[model samples]
Target: MRIGILGAGRMADALGTQWARAGHELMVSGRAPEKAAALAERIGPAARVGTFREAATFGDAVLLAIRDDGVQDVLAAAGAADGTLQGRVLVDCTNPVVPEKLTLKTAGGPSMAERVAAATRAHVVKAFNLCHEDVWRMTPPVFDGVKLAVPLCGDDPDALALVRTLVTGLGCEPIDGGALERAALLEATAAFMIGLWFSGANAQAVIPPLKYAFGAH
Candidate 1:
């Protein structure tokens, strides 16, 4: 799979590293190409760095990993939700955590994923928001031993499948998180999770470390 990521921050590095190790081709882009290059080099030989336009053009799927406030800007700059992003599955990992408010920027109305979907018309899926960088960095290597559950949401079946495959490649179980509209819940949960980390618990400690639960069928 060819994955194009808009942000070259910790989230991209964490997941991109595992994707590359899993033999998926990756191209990372940011406001600066250098930052993308540096991260890509660390990922593996298959990963490359490019401009936002090029990244969008090169990838079969797009992962938006920019900051909460910067989501709109990066999407506009990267041509997401526009002519370029047509028919692409956009896996949004944004949390919308306002620095001043310390909560979500989209509190009153629809969620961030809704805004992006309305703007782009592409398939939007909420995923990877609940995870911390350390979780992906330290855990994916020992998948069978750890079996982490990763949740994702989108309207498109195919897009959801792709995200599931990507999550599995990262050594995590992909729980279907319902529709794109339900993305607000995920973002809010992420915000609460961040606050929990500040409550003296280790980041991964909050993540349960379970793959999936069995039912009493």
Candidate 2:
């Protein structure tokens, strides 16, 4: 698959490297040309650098990996509001949280994913926002013999399917996280988990095993 990545930051580097290794073609773009070039180089021949607009239109699916605050400006520069991203599969990995406070910027409104969808008019999928960059950099992201599970939320079936394939390519399991309307929950969950992690708490311990979720009866 041809994938376009809209940032050259850690998330871009980690996920792009993994995807490139999975034999996907990549076009990486960012506000910093040098960073984009360096990331593309790190990913080898399967990757190349481009401008924001070029990356937006270069792939079967585009990964919006930029910072939450810069999303609107970047999308506008990529012609998203002008229909350049229309009908495309847009995977949103951004989390709208104010890291210092570990609170959501959305403030009980639409999620970052929904905002992106409104801007791009694309088939948007909310995913890859739950973990840190290092987790994605892991070869398979397994823990105690259990593969990491990536939850995805999207309204479009085809778009979700494509994202699920990408998740599988990372040697992780894909979990259906319901429709796009439910993405706010995921974003909130991210904020909560991040806060827990920052406080040196094991967020995973808060959730019981699947078999115990509804009682062992």
**Residue 13 CA error for candidate 1 (Å)?**
0.8
Candidate 1 positional error at 43, Å: 1.7
Q: Which residues of candidate 1, in runs, are more than 4 Å off?
A: 141-146, 201-217
Give each model a TM-score.
0.87, 0.98
- lDDT by residue (27-140, candidate 1, tens digit) is 899987788889988888989998887777777798888887787778788786456777888888888887545588898889999888887777888898886777888645
Candidate 2 matches the true fold with a TM-score of 0.98
lDDT of each: 0.82, 0.95
Candidate 2, 100-123: lDDT as tens digits: 899999977899999999989999
Point out the worst 10-residue segment of candidate 1 by lDDT. Answer: 208-217
Off by over 4 Å in 2: none
